[model samples]
Target: MNNNAYNINIFSGGAELLFDNKRHYNIDLPNKDTWKLGDLLIWLRDNLLSERPELFIQNNSVRPGILVLVNDSDWELMVSSDLWYLICSLCQILCKYAPCP
Candidate 1:
């Protein structure tokens, strides 16, 4: 593995159906120091998301009704002053979308 590259696991809960029903992904992200949660979100949208990108992303962040957990911690609690949290190696990211009423 490249020095700048690190592995991460992504889990899609209720949102798996939108990603062709695939619930898990083992991703190797290239670039470590420069990567942030915001960047990861964009990367996921452009590279992994199969459909309904709008439902998952809005204003450069996840839309309402969707929960993003980083390393088992709520993303909101991890956000920094700029709202972009630095991503660490071997972290787990879980994206869960609440069912519509």
Candidate 2:
């Protein structure tokens, strides 16, 4: 992945987006990430939908939602999701190659 770019997909409510560097747009994320599906959903709900709606892309794109099964466990047990683990791991890796702000 391009660490220099904040090419993260922000999803909230009914929006999907790709923030490539500082340029945001609507795009399809047909790839997989390390985040636990449920945790990512929670993060999006809290961060994007409720907090910074400006980071979301408003267009006719598919909802940018994280969909993944963590260790074959359904994400309804609340704490069994691996989303935070994946996020923390990814953050550590990205931090090593962070782009200068």
Predicted structure with the largest lDDT when compared to the true one? 1
Q: Write the per-residue lDDT of candidate 2 for residues 13-36, one digit (tens) a residue.
A: 223322223222222223455454
lDDT of 1 by residue, 1-101 (tens): 55434344455667776676787777766655678888988888888888989988998788898888888888888775558887776667888888688
> Using alpha carbons, what is the TM-score of model 2?
0.24
Worst 10 residues of 2 by lDDT: 91-100
Taking every candidate in turn, the Cα RMSD to the unseen true structure, in Å, is: 2.1, 13.6
Task: Give the lDDT of residue 33 in candidate 2.
Answer: 55
Residue pairs in candidate 2 whose N, alpha carbon or C atoms collide under 3 angstroms: 36-83
Judge candidate 1 at residue 56 and give its lDDT: 86
Candidate 2 vs. truth: CA RMSD? 13.6
